[model samples]
Target: MSLFDTYIAVDWSGGNDRGAKPKRDAIWACAAGEEPVYLRNRQVAEDWLAARLEAEAGRRVCVGFDFPFGYPAGFAEHLTGREDALALWDWFEARIVDAPDVNNRFDIAGEINARVSGVGPFWFNGLKREVNHLPRKGLDRTNADFPEKRLVEMRAKGSFTCWQMAGAGSVGSQVMMGLPVLARLRRKYGAKVWPFEALDSAVAFVEIWPSLLAPSFPGGMIKDAAQVRAVARAMAVMDGQGSLELALAKGEGSGAEGWILGVGAEDLLEAAMKPIDMPRPPKLRDDCFALPAGVDWTPVDEALARLDAALRCVVGVEQVSHTQVVGRVVAEPVTARRSNPPAPNSAVDGYGFAHDATGEGDQVLPLLAGRAAAGGAYGGTVPHGSAIRVLTGAVLPDGVDTVVLEEDCSVTDTHVAFRGPVRPRANTRKAGEDVVAGSDVFAKGHMLRAQDAGLLAALGVDALPVFKRLRVGVLSTGDELVDPSQNAPPDRTYDANRPMLLQLAAAWNFEAVDLGHVRDDRAALKARLDEAVGQCDVILTSGGASAGDEDHVSALLREQGNLQAWRIALKPGRPLALALWQGVPVFGLPGNPVAAFVCALIFARPACLKLAGAAFAEPQGFMVPAAFEKRKKPGRREYLRARMGSDGVEVFASEGSGRISGLSWSDGMVELPDGAMDIARGDLVRYLPYGSFGL
Candidate 1:
């Protein structure tokens, strides 16, 4: 059976403020099993939908609005350095203003176009001739950065680009004005946006192109309530046929480039909804966590400092051969086994002679009788009138204080002549110059690299003392989670957090132990903890830390061990729970994949390093201009997944923590600190690259 119990279709507008009556320019809404209604303004439309959604919180509902859910992927990246569709709404919300008689949709569109390229791609400005930025041309040269069509635009035949703001078949104005209303709806009710955030048990907002359904409605009912009613009925039919999901299935570039639900499902809608042979995944749970009352929230810096202070390195070191010690932390300082070279040598292919052998007027000297090579040196001192032939790296002959380059001298079998002045020891390497005897080559806590190992080998050190690798136990705790290898029942999901964490641990050079999954029951969690406490230096678990009925991880920790903190003043990763179980450190991460990944890198990486007898690693961030704007409250820090672009770093278009795709799409994160608000375009912000975290 389809999860959704109701379907709603809305015909959005892009013109000036909504009309007082049901007109072509006003917002129109119709729901399956209900009469079509005309809303006078955006606010009323929002209120009407909000009321219905509030009453049906327990039932699944899907609302489809006739507007572009997101811009073309390139425009989003160029303007905001983000591919998240919801972020583009934030960009519009800060700039566009909607009023009954007038709206700034055209102005906003022009502003965005100006930022995209010197010449705007959005053309055909409205009746107002004063909006000089938009050209009147039907087609014009476009910026390569901003493509004319979104992925859906190319896929759906006869579809119009969301860029057209004026003229016939233009939905651009509706997009600018409509997005803010949708943003409010999503924010007030925490509605999931399809293809970005996962479908919700309560409600989801999807993008629909009404024209795709218009042909199904008979003639004479082209552009009014009748058309909306017909479209709503079509939705009901599609839903009943079990083809709604096929339409809702993510299309190519659906997240950043919006897709029209049911755009290409002609024959599929004719079939009846049937159960698939494969096992179904679990229904999504709304178990978001926040800081508990009466508990003081810890700042990120302070929390890290406290964690490092409390963690002690795991004891025990192993002696490893120098060649095998690469990437291992040194347990003790390594001193030079012997002085480098053990004797003075030539720095270049040159001649060796006494510094004062040449007279003031006679710069040329007779070729020396003795010759010095790398392994064999001249035994006796050279005569004052002669010079010795010494190749590069050859030991200096006895009584030779200087060496001259072969290129600077004209040489024959009998004599050598100088073209320039030669300084004493100019091309000579003194004994112990590279490394003196007993000098420390590498200090304790230094992670040995290939070059360091090679240098140690050169010094004849065969074995080295290095700290033993720390063992990390990874666990996934949730009744709704199942192993991917197993056939999961409905209401269960394949575990993703455990495998991801295990892979990350391996990359960080830790001995990762898969502690496996635990049920939500307190006893099951306790048993898993007991099994892991003695086997690993650190334990990491995903889920079961929230204040939900099924959550047991936090409760078990509070009763059996120290439950230090429940949440940090951070976004996405706020629900982190830290504890100590039988003296083994435990990190309880949020169940959301993105949240789990971010928390692991931010909080877990440093803690693991400290436990492995390595120096605390502080990830450095670079400052870059924000391609998009954001308005947020002060106090808590927020991290938006982003990727580096040719211009600057762009954030992921969506902020849904449930969207695991964001982790792979993003190269790093953009940090908004406490008290940060209103990030205008081109504002400097701190960017943390994933590579900086040693990933």
Candidate 2:
């Protein structure tokens, strides 16, 4: 039996209307076991597809559309700070406007081209649309951010540039209108869009270059319906022979950049073609870590840069009351609702006078007719050379520009004699000095503290828009592990990594969820992950990450999601596993408690902060003298648990990662550089305190 109940091939149109019969300006759809359908517009096609998909409920349905699912990978990263092809679909869906005969595909293409450095990437505007930015000629203009063609487009001989919207053979218009339909289908049917997301899903929607398959049919058949029918029939035959599955397996591209469904079956196609050289690795890998052989292990700095580029902030914002916003990160810029002090007020309990008192000789001024106290002010302007009795924080009377402290002046009931010289506006608080009206008090991504809350409250702000706390699920997996409260056999020990990680998460202002422990059974680990993925923004687990015979976490992830990267060049923590399970990020640390602690501090903590929409955090470290001699390898960087003493920083007696007591015994850690070296006593070493990592 075929893997899917039906196979569909669609030839899309860029034109604005349902052209006359036999014209190529209408959508043509052909399904296995059914005749080809010529749809007049996008809405009609979408309604038709939705009904077909609903009729095939509980069965796998495979659909292929003729258009670029995503643009060139570099353009994607430059626009979205990510290279995932699926993200491009969302980007287009948000920007492109598709109406039956009045779409703005050409205009949007011109707008996107303007963002890049050069012109002509998106040339060839439609006849009616006058896009000033889009140039007609000079299509050879170079932009460093975008490639000339996507990988699949270059691989297929007859493919056109998705950037060209108006010219003949241009796929740009089709892409702009097609992606929104694909996004809607994905939302309604949960269809797996290939090369942008993965192909492990049941109901799959893939990108197809109809020209790649159009050559197999008889020549001189110019009808669009005949082309789609021939391609659909050919795909059904391929499905019967199990060639379709092989094609899907071979078409996997860097995530969400699309690959043609039949690129892998170039040999089977009638056209005599040489293999097109796919672009060199774009300095990024979406499916897995590029642990190429003969390459040295990644340095700590390079690893951190890669991690930052690969991750994105979790979505969604929350309205938090000012009183309860402490420890929350701001999701939007916070503006001051009102100026501090609101009006001109006295900076001290003193006498206010209208004079440049700091002149050569002290000017004796008469007392003002009224007194201005806090919560009660003197309304009228002060007479010339007259002083007003003003208390601290009271609004200063008009015409009085300076204040002289009561002690600085010899005072009497009728008048006051100023002895010390004073400058204009001295000791007078100006309106809006502390906080100007409509000024941004706090920017987005600022983590709220006690003082921040107090400042917001003073501005009369009762609520703030803050990112919701990242809920981290912590777990420990091992067959020989038991709960801390339960007794264990001599061969087994209590679970410590979970509690430590949970506490660390809480300390770092995350919502920590203890997922309990699971044995090394594959089924058991899978069950725990299924439970945690929905509740947590990210999952952290200790043990079972290594490629041991009984290790199940890595194995389960391989089956359910994807294992992106594993292992880092850092001592005390090396067997680190990074994966995605049901779209939730998972960070797997070593089983050893000490290693788990170090990894949590170095990796998981920063990852959590990013997910919570906070900025990158690098714990500050200082250089201190090495108090004890130590030897280390050359390649991987190492951290030694140590305490500061009279001489300098002292290393822990033992180097084992399982030595949990060493963490508490030492005040912080001493970092050693990569390369084989000997640390002599009194040698300078970089030191980081536990507090620096937000202990």
Candidate 3:
């Protein structure tokens, strides 16, 4: 069954009321498989829609309106002191004062402009008489505090700016006037608005642009009427095909600025009207950390490839406040809510004037009485053949397209002189230049840094959805091991691997849980494993992982859990046991401290990050010249603890896996390939720095 049983489209009007007769610019609405119905004014249109919706009770319906349901990001908060589109709607609904033929839309526009600036971002007064701050022409207004177009407008080609009020292609007035009606209908019917709320309601409203589809009806019908009918039928057809739900899915920049229905699904709409077959998206499976069959002795590259294929983001998402998001992975794309700098402003301290006002050569122009500073804009427009003093970061006054730096100009009490041939629109930052509204700032799986938090703050984002941190439990198994705080006999050594592994997990931004140490007993290790599964998402065991008699970790996994014993061809680390205990992934590492650390860096770190909802990233390595020479065999790969010396990269004095002091002595690792290699002094070799592993 289709999600929606009915679809309706409305072509709204923002101009003064037309008489009680069928006309072109009056409000028009059409239901699927029905003729267009014309309403004389806003009041009649609202009444007709309410009646139609009331008659369609118990049926799922979607209403599409041509006017924008929202303004650009930051506009709602700027006007209403809250970052909510519905609040802005309420704000307008309380003060709009709409009647059949006479409304205070122009006065309201002027009032809104007065709050933002004495001059406007809102313009085009269609009335004959003047309004307080509203201008008649777009060029007469200074829009230095907000972007002229919304993010959706930039993406939807040929879309009109929501700033224009009553001139040709003006959508701004419609938004200001239409939102009040939408608010009333939503409150009365409990209908949800698309892109703002989840589409779970029986009656849902969507923002539509009728121009997206060409209308085909008998000749002589009003263009607006034809459009509403065409759009309404198209929506119903697409809904039946099941492609409409995909089109309504929330995307980048749709959070605050809203979205046009079928913006990216133009092809689907066209094909749906023709009744053609549509492709459905494939279903995704969460088979994270699942091992493939038939894996035995593995190469370094092959092991890494297998791990990459088996891993996916296994953590759930949460909306975290911007202040606490650092080091958290983004669950979705974080887009810019508002542009940085917001509007065009002077880049340097200068004399601002219109660039085309004069011809080439040295020129002089009268100075305006006041200056445009960073906090305040010049109240009046900058006339031709005149200039105004403007400081760095100041919003350029209307008609001022260019600025000549103070250092390049000669100033007097009433005038300023500068060399001619200045470039048009020079020394000025364009609106949305640094960061554009609706543009993606960070993609999914991105880890937030301190600077990222600052950028989000500047964009007015209070909170964002981020994946929860992965929980990693560290366990060590060895009969000869004891805690560092306890006295140990000569046969026993202090437990170094557990503490190191715990710290490493913490450094990698995972929630580190100390599962404590387990001795070489099958029943005791099993109890610890069961407990870890309840407390952690993943477990790490550092000893008794090989196929020896005392290898309880591998033996227990083989008997009670799913186990994959991988004998990797590598120095220091060879026997790697991977398993799933109670559906939680467990990594089994070697007993030697240095070998365990190497294996953790090479394999476990990236896999853990992937499970934590971070993108799988390979450890970055660069080539550095070797300071020492050595001959290697063709069978096993080797990594020597190393650091950059005065001449080149210097390897540790020994290649023994038990040399725990070598790890602390070195800053990175020097990797040797599997094939036989004869390395001499000054021969370049790949160097993997500790920092590259996120240490």
Candidate 4:
């Protein structure tokens, strides 16, 4: 069966009435397999739509509207005191005054602009008289409070901004006037709006772009009429082919700004009316971290891009107590079970009374017998002209809308007296003020912190789904190295890389597994890797990662696994061998202690976090004036060990990769761009603290 029995498309408009004749720049609607019809105005359009929906009861139907369903992210919360699009619809429906030939949309727009900023986010009034706050041209408005375009508009190329009101391509006025009608229909018919709500309802509304598909128009047909008809027919055809469900897939921010159906599925929509050969989906690869071919001496940014595109979370999820979830990556979004504070409560130790009891001058009120304290609230309603003593966190008794702080009152055994002019609902916290019940508190892939634990407890979330810790196996290679605990020969050195890497992995909240040290023999390295694949989700090896003859780490990977020895254009570290052995990812790091540390921080850390089921996030860096002067050549990025000093950021004296002391000498790193430049003492440079990299 098809997803929908009927499909409807509407070309919406916001301007004043244009007589009874069918024309452009007016509302028009078309149902699949039916003729396009002209709508005189919004009132008639709403009536006709309601009648159609009533007649189509019990049959699955989908309606597409041309105007935007919502504004940018913060606009709803700023104007309506709620972050929901439907709430904004109700807000507009309550305030907007619409009639057959005239409306107060421009005035309402001006009022909204006055609330946000006097200049305008909503502009271009078409009225003959100048409208205050609403500018006549886009150039006169300063839209600094919010974004000019919604997130969906940015992705859909050639789409007009939803901020302009009277311009040729403006959709702002249409949204202001049209959302109210849709809101009424949705409430009356129980129809679900796509993305904002689930699309399981018999009647569903979706955002649509008529220009998304190019269809042949019948001769002498108006462009708006032809567009509506074409879009409706295309949607119906796609539904019959069982491909319309794919077009309704939800994306990021779709719930907030709404997505245009078929915007991302242009090819499928174009081929809906024709028979075509569909290519078979490619086979899934077992090796996910395999680098692309011909990638040689890649730039640092390019290498990061490749890694971000290739990696996916490889761990399984389990339910853990909120108490133990710190440092764990969330596998599912956690919604609040109850609101913070749970009920209206006093914000200070004070006397609570109804605001209307006292006015004009100093008034005296008699005290109630009982007092409301934390965990012990007064049972009865607070009578007018009477005050009840209440402490912070104590639930406000009925009939009490205001609280006068005890410090501001002269209290005796029988009565409490305070000054006049107490604000309504003063010194009292409203229920759901901090967090509302059923609202999303944390999204999937969020790494929990200690503060998150307190929030979870407050929200009554006892347990949550979290990904299992990634098991990272650390293995150090080289015949000249021995464990620090062991007696080493004069020619041998201690295996510092293994201990350092293992500790770093643990510090990053991963399960660090000691794979021990392996010599430069190919057979020994192969045995160690074969064992590591089963015990670890990822294997990290230092030394023997280069293309040298004794580079058994690279040799074994090239011979047995999918290996790509990426020579990155970065100072201190260059050779980075990424491979997959037996479906487990492996990171081959440098032999030098300094290079291994830098490469691990800059490259391996983010990749590992993603693989451990955490969301992809770049380490934040801040710009600071440089304390030292240096002239750097182009082609490779340089990172100098740095620390914040009195002048600005001070770098270590040397840039040698073998100087392991430099790593410990500084608290952070200063990064230089790839282009050649002369950095003076006063010049600004990007600095990244160790904490920013999850140190």
Choose the strongest candidate by lDDT. Answer: 4
Candidate 4: tens digits of C-alpha lDDT, residues 260-373: 887777776776533223232222244555556765679999888888888888877654545457789988899987899799999999999999888967878999888998
- Candidate 4, pairs of clashing residues: none
Candidate 1 has an lDDT of 0.76
Regions of candidate 3 where Cα sits further than 4 Å from its true position: 1-295
lDDT tens readout by residue for model 1, 1-695: 34466667788777665556566756888775455798887777778999988887876677888888888766676666787788887777778788767777777766766766556678777765556567666566365666778788787777888778877888787888888888888888888887777785478888877666454443443275655565555555565445667777745446587777766664553221111223312211112122335768777776777677666676456545454566678888988776787689998888878887654443788886768988787888877767899988788877787888888888888898885456667899999898886799999988787899668756645445677778899999888999999999889998999999999998888889999988878887898899897688888988988777887888887787667555578888887787777777788988898889988998899888877878888889999988877898988888899988876778888999988898899999998887759988788889999888877
Better of 1 and 2 by lDDT: 2
| Deviating ranges (above 4 Å) for candidate 4 | 1-293
Rank the candidate models, highest lDDT first. 4, 3, 2, 1
Provide TM-scores for the models.
Answer: 0.55, 0.57, 0.59, 0.59
The TM-score leader among the candidates is: 4
Tens-digit lDDT string for candidate 2 (1-695): 35555678888887776854645657999874345788888888889889988987876778988888888767778777887666767887888887776887877877887787867577777766478677665455565666768877787887887777767788888888898888888888889877656555567897777677554554454567766766665565565445667777776644556787787676543231111222211212345343456545677777776667676676466444454577789888988877886888889998997765335465667775669998898889887767789999899888788888887878777878876557778898899999976799998888888998678766755445677788899988888998878889999988888888999999988899999988878888888889997788889988888777877877777666677445678998887788877677898888899999988888888777877888777788999888899778788888889999998989899998878999989989988887788889988989999888877
Instruction: Give the Cα-based TM-score of candidate 3 against the true structure.
Output: 0.59
* lDDT (CA) per prediction: 0.76, 0.76, 0.84, 0.85
Worst 10 residues of 1 by lDDT: 280-289
In model 2, where is the ten-residue run with the lowest total lDDT? 272-281
Which segments of candidate 2 are over 4 A away from where they belong? 1-296, 357-359
- Candidate 1 lDDT score at position 565: 54
lDDT of 3 by residue, 596-627 (tens): 99999998998888888887778899899999
Candidate 2 backbone collisions, by pair: 85-256, 196-256, 289-564, 368-387, 634-675, 634-676
Instruction: Report the candidate with higher lDDT, 2 versus 4.
Output: 4
